[model samples]
Structure formats: C-alpha cells, structure tokens
Target: MDEADWLAARFEEQRPHLRAVAYRMLGSQAEADDAVQNSWLRLSGADTADVDNLAGWLTTVVARECLKMLRTRRSRREEPIGDTTAEPSAGDHDVNDPEAEALLADSVGPALMVVLDNLAPAERIAFVLHDIFAVPFDEIAAILERSPAATRQLASRARRRVQGATPPRQVDITRQRQVVQAFLTALREGDFDGLLAVLDPDVLLRDGSAELTPGAAGLLRGARAVGAHALAFSRAARFVQPALVNGAVGLAIVPRGRLIGALGLTFRHDKIVVIEMIADPERLRHVGLAAVGP
Candidate 1:
C-alpha cells in the first residue's frame, strides 16, 4: 500500500479514541465531529515523516481545536452547558465523520458530561488528557503551555469540580431492599434529598417504559440528578407496590391494582446502583408480581 493509504488506515484506527476525547471536551455531537474532522484535515497537510507519536500528535491537534471552540463559545456568551441535548451514542460513529464514536463500555455518562461542560477550556483539556486519557501531565503541560505544576493544578481543579458533580465513590448495597423501599417512599413524598440519600453516587437509572420516550438515554446519574428525576415523576410512585423480582425485592407499578411497570433495582453497599425501570405491559407479565402489605 502507498503512504497515503497507510496514513488513512492509521487515522481510522485512532478515530474512536479521538472521538471519545473530543466528545468529553466539547459535549456536543456536531462540535465533536467538527473537531475530529478538523484534526484529520490538519493531519493530511502536516509534514509527519519525522513524527514519532501519531496518536499523541492527533490528540494534541484535536485538543487544540476543541479548545478554540470552547473559547469562542465562552466569548460569544453562547454557553450551552447541560442543556437537553441527547447524550452521545457510544460506539456509534458517523459513517462519514468516522471519528464520532465514543469510548466503548466506559462512555462518559450524562451527569459527568454536564460537569465537564462547565469547566474552563484549558482546565477541561488538562483534565481530559491527564485524567481521562491517561496522558502524562508533563506532556499535557506542553499542550496547555503551562508548567507541569500548573498543569497538575488544572487537572486537580477540574477533578474537584467533577467530584462535586458526581456521586460518592463507594457503593453500599447490603440492605438494597430497604434502600429501594425508602427510595420509593421518598419519591412518593417528593422528598428529593431523602431519595438522593439512598442512591449510589453514580447511580445509573434507565427507564425503558412504553409510556415514555423509546431509547436508553445517558442521563440520570448521581443522587442529585437521579433524585431530581424521581421527584419530577413522583406521582407515579404512589401507585407502585412491592413485588418479587427474580427472588429479590422489586417494585410493581400498580395504579388501583392494575400492574403496568416493574422496577428491579441493583444495589451496592446499601445504595441503589442500577435501577431497571420497565414499563412495557407485555414485559410486565413476566415480573411475577406479588404484593407486600403497607
């Protein structure tokens, strides 16, 4: 194969990684694709015969483009942080864009992406490179034009900001049934703080009910985010009754004794970690509903 073909192949391999980095940096599908495309354009024109680290080179290129986009948005006062944009679809790349795929298995959650969007451009780049991509701080220092110590500070600040936005680092599912019960009670009462207290720090709540939108959204994470969601839909909790799901404690959506939905929760150290809320009537028939007296 010729040098051009080899180069194209090499870039394709790195596209997924590049896309993941861009998504975390920009938090917009269209913007991330633009950054990745710009990076390829730059790569095609650059003299890379002597370049040793192609991945690092492309990463640096993409980071610069994302940084420019962030700064421009900030200057124009067009801050689009945490709006209702649909989350990035992991492992799904634009056929033409090629670099829009997210990191597999470990794609950034909707809650975390909201936090990253709030960070400054340089802080976001430093954090993504060093913390997310595992790029060395010394190398990131060069990218951000800061000393190693300052670079570390940027990542540190960004890390702290993210921590504040995310759930607690540990999971406690020992009394998961009790936790789920309390969660339901809290939801019924519209006690947002009480509900958050029982959710895993990074709880993933996926609602695939026939009554609502028909897709798995990357939204609903952390206690606060999940709590807000639960509170918003608290009216539904009033009709939920305890049930046996796969021999574990679960919730059945019963309004006036008519079964409609099933919520089987996964716990970690007394916390609700993963909430599987299924509202499809056909699927509900398989949940083995049994009532618990209030």
Candidate 2:
C-alpha cells in the first residue's frame, strides 16, 4: 500500500475512539461525526513520519474541532425559550440507524449528556478528556492552552456539577425517581389519565420561561389543566427523560439529543404538586444536573 493508503487505514482504526471523544465533548452524534471527519481531513494532509503517537494526535485534533463547534454553538444559539420541538432533525450521519444511536446513548446516558451540555466549552473538554478518557492533565492543558493546574481546576469544577455536590431534597430519592419516571412514561404515551394519575388534584404549574406572560398568566392550576397543557406539547416528552435536577429527580427535555429545557416537579403524597418549567438559557446554566441512574 502507498503512504496515503497506509495513513487512511491507520485513521480508520482510530475512527471509533475519535468519534467517542467528540461525542462526549459535543453531546451530539451528528456533530461528533463532523469533528471526526474534520480530524481525518487534517490528518490526511499532515506529515506523520515522525509522529510516535498517531492515536493521541488524532484525539487532540478531534477534540479541538469539537471545542470549536461548541463555542460556535454557544455564541450562535437562537432557539426560542421553552422550545420543546422534539424530532431527530440532525444532519445525515447515522440518523437512520437506530442501533448506532442506541449504542451512542449507552456509551453516554441521556442524563449525563444533559449535564455535559450545560458545561462551559473548556470545562467540558477538560473533564471529558481527563476524567472520562483518562487523558493526562498536561495533554488536556495543551488542548485548552492553559496551565495543567488551571485545566485541573476546570475539570474539578465540572466534576462537582456532574457529580452533584449539593444533597437532594429531604425526600425518598428512590420513590421520587419512580414517580418522575412514571410521569415521563405517561407523558410519552400521551395518556392524559396517566398524567392526571400522578399529578395532585390541586397541582400548580408555573412557567418560568421567558416566552410566558408575567404574573398570574404564567400559572396553571388543577391536575386537568396541567395534564392537558402537558399533552399539548407532549411531543417533547419523546425527548424528555428523568434526570437529577438541582439534586432531585426531575425531567430534562433533550430534543434531538440536545438539552434545551428542564421540568422541576415538586411532589406531595407521592403525586406531583408543583411543576416548574425552566427554559431560560441563563437559568439552565445555573441548574445543577446529574445522572439519575447508573
């Protein structure tokens, strides 16, 4: 084989590893593929005759690409508040391949991805590289162009949020997870009665999204009203999943595998009594998120 063919084969060998890194960094399968492809483009044009660690080189390239994409996404974000449009509207990569998507989901659970989505670009890169992949701090520091100590601090901060430093509310966490899971299942199945079943008779739904009107107009009372309202946008339930929101069980709306909103529900007598819809980007940034299960 020629030099180009030999290099192509080597790159193909590292494709999965590179894609996995990108996925954890970007939290979007489509973007991960793009980052990997971009890395390949760079690799194909570079001279690697003296390179002793091709895999490491490729990982760094893809990570940098992912970091760039993340920064761009943050700066250009313009989605409407409380946006619950759930559909697999991503570009052509592995969209039609459910098995591929499922594999990706298993590698990085929905809950963790939601938390990763809220992390700062540098912090996400640092944490994913150092913590998840076991990359060295010096190497990650090179990627972020910061000192190793600074990079370590970034990873530490991200770790605290991902692991949830604050204790959950004074309630039965196991029961709350079950209740939240049931509510999500009901919402996804479009079972109005199921929604009402888990919601208290006098449940109060408050809209903290910027899209809602102020004062009493943002509040909806009664199980019927809340259930009906949830069903109105039940399509979002398809992407919503149970997650640890602010140290307790809650729902995160991750349409197209990207977290955009979260539902903070308060329970009473094992029934949901208050539902808080938080969609403002700033508010979401401050909300602590952790994985609900292993």
Candidate 3:
C-alpha cells in the first residue's frame, strides 16, 4: 500500500483513543472534535519515514493541539451575566426524555472528573495523562514543557487532593424524585417545616446566578438546609422536573416552562453534599440538555 493508504489506516485505528483523550482534556465534545481533526490534518501532511510509534506520536500531537486551544480560549474574555432568576418558558418541557435520562444517568458517573476540575490546567493535564490514561511521565513532561520530576510532583499533588476528597454517595432515583416532590410541595404550600424534614442536615443551597454559600453559616444545617433551599427555589420556580445529570439524578428548574437552569446533586451516605447549579448559558450548553426530547 502507498504511504497515504498506510497513514489512513493508522489514523483510523488511533482515532477513538485520541478523541477520548482530547475530550477529557478540554471538557467539551466540540472542542475535542476540533483538536482531533487538527491532529489528523497535521499527520496527513507530515513525513512518516522516521515516525517510530505512530500511536504515541498521534497522542502527542493531539495533546499539543488541546493545549493550544486552551491557550487561545483563555485569551478571549466575555462578561458574565447572572440573571437566571427569570422563569423558564414552554421550551423547558420539550427537553425532558426517559431514554436520554437513563443513558446519561448511567454513563456520566462522578469520580476523577469532578476533582480534576479543581486543579490548574497544567496540573490536571499531568494527572490525567499520567494517572488516568497511564501515559509515561517522559511524554507528559514533554507535553507540559516541564521536567519529568516536576510533572511527577504535579500528579502527586493532584492525587493527594483526590484521595483526601469524599466520594459522592449514591441516591436511588425514586427516592430522589420523592425528595424533590416533597420539597416542592412544601414550598407551594408555604410550609417551611415540612420542607425541612426531607433535607440532609448539612444541605447546600446555591442560586444559579450567584456564588454558593459555604456550609459554615447557612440555614438548616445538613438536612434542614437542604429542605430550606429546595423550599426557597420552589416558591419561585414554575416547574421542577427530575433529570439525569452526568449520570446522576438531578433536577431541571423552569420558571414558566422556559429553559432557565439546572441542579446536579451528589449524594454521600444518602445525604446530598454537592449541589451544582448551572445558570450560566455557556456552561448549560455543555450539559447536553438543549436538544433533549420531551
């Protein structure tokens, strides 16, 4: 076969892995696709005579492209507006689906991804490549432009943070739905005490457009706060529908049935600890709900 045919075969074999790596690094499917396409373009034009490990070379190229995209993305800035308080319109109901919910409810389980978000870009890249994908430190060092020891140190720090962190406890979908229903009921009825019964003692409440309130000084510590936060939102929210978020049971709140906001819940020991509410439009697009079915 000619070099062109040989290269095409090689690219096909490595495409899936390359896409996976890019997706994890960039945290956006669209961006990952772009990075992978760029890698293929570069490979198709390069001299293949001296290429020893095609797979490794392709991965390196993709990683470098992802890093470049990150740099370019960082250079652009846009002001953020926090106006998620408005009620959702009728379009919100159209995005609900049983099948999509089931799929997302199963595949997007929380683990390293959550903790990875907290790390700096370089640290995250180092940890993901070395720990998650088992890429060699030498390759990671080359990608990050740091010494191998430094890359090791970065991975070490990231590992410590992940190890020390608490894993989210699992919550059954039926029970979660019940909790949301009860919380909403109390809110509609103007019964704060009823709402308090359904929440964990260390519950967290966050408005989609505002910064989250820490656990130190909040209403209804634990369960009580959980109930109170639900109540607060229910009072103004037009509809609270349960949906799957990153493979977890979550709620999408719509005021007047429009697509306004969503909340991702992480349960630990049957208590909700991580409640991530996305009211930012840019972040919402990543949640994959814009095209969901009714």
Candidate 4:
C-alpha cells in the first residue's frame, strides 16, 4: 500500500483510543474530537521517511496539542463547565436483568468520578491510562514528560487517595433514598441547625462557577460556612427532586421543568463533606431525574 493508504488505515484504527485519551485530558468530548482531528492533520503533513512507532508518534503529537489547548485555556482564564449537580435516572439504562444492571451501575458510579476528580491532572492521566486502559507506564511517562518512576509515583498517589477515601455506606437503594430525602427535607424546611448536624465539621463547599478568590470564594471550609451556603441556596432556589448521580446521592433543579442545574453530594463517615453544585447550563445535558428510590 502507498504511504497515504497506510497512514489512513492506521489512523482509522487508532481514532477511538486517541479520542478516549483526549477526552480524559481535556474533559470535553468536543475538545477531544478537535484534538484528534488536529493530530490527523499533523500526521498527514509530516515527513515520515524515518518515523517509527507511528502510534507513539501520533499520541505524542496529540498530547502536545491537548497541552497547548489547556495552556491557552488557562491563559485566557476560561473555566470548565463545572456544574455537576444533575443525577440521571436509572431508567436511562436499558438493562434486562437486575444483577447485570446493578453491576453496570456500580461500575460507573458517581463516587468513582468524584475520587477521580480530586486527583492532580498528571496523576489522573497516568492512572487512567495505566489502570483504566492498561497502557504501559513508559508510554504514560512519555505523554506526561516525567520519568517512569515519577509516573508510577503519580499513579500510586492517585490510587491511595481513591482507596483511602471513604465512600457513603448506604448502598441499599432504600437507605440511600432515606438519607437524601432527609437532606432535602432539612434544606427545604430551612433547618440550618439540622443540616449542620449531618455535615462534617470540616465540610468543603465549592461553588464551581464562582471566581477563585484567595480565601474568598471557590472553597468554603468548615461546617458553619457550608451550612450557610446550603441555607442560602435553599432560600433562593427550589430543587426539583433527588436523583442517583453516577451512583451517588444527587439532586436536579428545574425552574419550569427545563432543567436548570444539579448538585452531587459525597458523604464520608455518614457526614457530608463535599458538595459540588453544577449550575452551568451546558453541563446539565447529561443529568436528569433520579430513577432509583433514593
């Protein structure tokens, strides 16, 4: 086959893998698609007389492109669509058996993503590539520009955080329902004291949309501030209903059944610590009402 035909064949085979990597790096399907397209353009135009390991070469090109996009985005002060509050219902899945459905549900559970989100960018990349996709550390190190030893360290730290972090214990559908129902009741009733009772003393509340202020906005630490924030939201906005977001307790808000926002809550030791409210309209597309009882 001619060089063009050979390259075309290889690109077709690598597209899905490249897209997956790009999506994880950029955290947006649209950006991942663009990164893959740009990689093809570069590959098509490059001189390939002495190039070896085309897959590695293409991946390197794509990684650099993704990094460039990240840098440009940071320089321009563009924030990601951070509203992560909506919880899609279980009915969205069309599983036939209860056991199979339960397993699938557990696989992509919200708690997993929350732990993943807490990871540093490099650590996340390394862990996802190595653990999720089974990519070798040497390859991941190349993409991350670090020694393989350092890459392993990054993955180890991410693993430790995920393993050590406590997930909510109420796995039964009915029990999860009760906990969230209680939480919503407290919020709706404007019972700040009651809400504080269920919150961890060191709870962290993050308004993803707010500008990052040094000790001002973004991260609100302590139960007092967290409770106050919840009270303020309860007073100002009306939450539609609770839902199971990525397998964690979540709530969706609709001003007029038009899906306005979502909130994903994570619990540790039966006390809420992290509250992520996603108000950006664009990010609400994947979220919907909760299907499970809770």
C-alpha lDDT values of all predictions: 0.71, 0.74, 0.63, 0.66
Cα deviation of 127 in candidate 2 (Å)?
A: 0.4
Best by TM-score, which number? 4
Q: What lDDT is reached at residue 147 by model 1?
A: 98
Q: How well does each candidate superpose onto the true structure, as a TM-score?
A: 0.52, 0.50, 0.50, 0.55
Count backbone clashes in candidate 3: 18
Clashes of 4: 9
The best-first sequence of candidates by lDDT reads 2, 1, 4, 3
Give the per-residue lDDT of model 4 (tens digit) for 170-257: 3455555666677778888899888887888987676668753476667787888888777877854464587766456667776767
TM-score of 3: 0.50
Error of 1 at 123 (Å): 1.0
Candidate 4 to truth, TM: 0.55
Question: For residues 1-294, what per-residue lDDT tens digits would candidate 2 score against the true structure?
Answer: 999999999987667567667867876544676898899899988988899999999999998998889888889882111111111112222557664344344334445666777788999999999877889999999989999999999999999998883322345668988898888888888999999889999887878553333466678888998899889787767888888775457889888888899887666678988787878775576455667982
Lowest lDDT 10-mer window, candidate 3?
A: 79-88
> Candidate 2 vs candidate 4: which has greater TM-score?
4
